[model samples]
Target: MAFKHKSTLLILTAGVFSCTPAWAASVSVVGLFKDKAIVSIDGGRPRTLSVGQTVQGVKLVAADSGSASFDVDGKRRTLGMGQSFAGGAQPGARQSVSLTADARGHFAAAGSLNGYPMTFLVDTGATSIAISAAEAKRIGLDYKAGEVTGVGTAAGVVPAWRVKFNTVKVGGITVSQVDGMVVETGLSVPLLGMSFLNRMEMRRDGQTMTLTQRY
Candidate 1:
């Protein structure tokens, strides 16, 4: 079973890790259909569930092609197929967001930067959150005036701006004053890296990665 305190064996290449297990108590959206779904709890096993069915502390309130609505610990949560919900809670409780890998086994999360909608590719190896210069401008960020730096990319080294974000959010979790980098070249997708991940308790089981707030 995956948990926060245990360190799973991870292979590192060029100081970067891939498909490694990271963060939480686990819950998964195994299958999603027009109005039905299958979910699992704690990675123990998979079970087929339907609307209004409660299994392993998760109550499937509703299900559709794009999402599954669940009630956990008296709070309602909705997760897309393949995503997990281990850290589902209200504002006062432990907050978290769980993501499942796509066919390529890469974890991508739907969230926002400074309240503007954006997609984030979860990259644990990165030292800080990284965004493209275009994205920073789209989100009205003044990263151009931030600290100048150099960042290595697949193409080559490029000029980058180190900036602190006012807010970064995923699902119900929000983190503020997040240190990040705005690469002037060669980045299309923003990376959700250590600057944000380090603040959460993380765990993984198979293709699912869960992040829970440390506090």
Candidate 2:
């Protein structure tokens, strides 16, 4: 009788193991364009899909430059660049900001520098966050006290001052002790450059760009 009970228990354990479900595929939006989106399934290589197209059970319903809508497991969802969906579970809390491109494809946002409100033009080509001398003065920045330097501009190499900012905040994201440069001339608006961008994971879809803090 004991042998019979042990056999039944082993069979039940095996049945339970056989009924367990396989791991659900994880889908992430890595790129988005007009009527098309690039997605990674199960953390695999990115695959591009057009509207109404399906790949690995994930379907793209509609897509624009800024956002994309999809059908997953019979659920309709919309996501911006860098967002993801997995096993019907929502993404975790992460510091991220989204920017919409203008008609000219320029991405800009309203942010603060050292707690002062300002506008920033996203310029990936720039090496550091750049501020104009006039704007710095208006914000009560003692730019002249920083190290004197030269920054190349459209006009030519122009006078500049290298400084550090206490904080740079954009939307809900904030970075501390960011490197910056105050251009003495030839810069009309502040440029958000690699100094800040290097610490962010950038994702662009059509007219939408997402910046997620990495550190």
Candidate 3:
């Protein structure tokens, strides 16, 4: 049977993960079965966790018996079996990074928001970078000081906050003064949207995506 929950699960907040220096830790999906998954955090001992359970703040959101969704550092990210998020290139090392698609053809990356660790789900459909209120609060983003707005999802219209991120970094590419949206509720993951993507040269070939800094 599929694991289901009421919409209220959207607002559930938990403890944040341990902090390491930049490019120190990583997360990966090892095996996934309906409602259950095996994952590795920071390359430590691998373990099995049920949906909604968290391992060092990496909460398992959903499992399709093939791919699994995880809430890493307050951002929702999906990954198929065997896909991993790695510590990025060294500081001032390079200005480009490549991402490989998981078995489910989804692209994800390890990054940061305002120097806070985060996981980014590639969403070309999103107009700007999108974060959940839970995430905005965790990362100390002053979204309420920005404009109030609403976002239309399949469920309905939900309240959102329009704010600017001081800096968003993925691998070695960092974009400053990025526009972002904070959904008041009903958003589980933070989307790596166009506000950041538009600043880079994005190219996809088969299962690999290459992102290079533009300026």
* Model 2: worst 10 consecutive residues (lDDT sum): 1-10
Query: Residue-wise lDDT of candidate 2 within 16-101, one digit each (tens)?
Result: 11001022334678899999999765443467989999755578999998989988767887888988765532355456666777
User: Candidate 1, overall lDDT?
Assistant: 0.69
Model 3, 106-171: lDDT tens per residue? 666666788676776777877888888999999888889988877776566777888989988775
Worst 10 residues of 1 by lDDT: 1-10
User: Model 2 scores what on Cα lDDT?
Assistant: 0.69
Q: What is the TM-score of each predicted model, taking all chains together? A: 0.60, 0.57, 0.59
Alpha-carbon local distance difference test for all models: 0.69, 0.69, 0.70
Which residue pairs collide in model 1, if any? 22-202, 22-203, 22-204, 23-202, 23-203
Per-residue alpha-carbon lDDT of candidate 1 for residues 68-156, written as tens digits (9 for 90 to 100): 88877667888998898655354467776667776656677666688665667778877788888988888788988988878777666
Off by over 4 Å in 1: 1-88
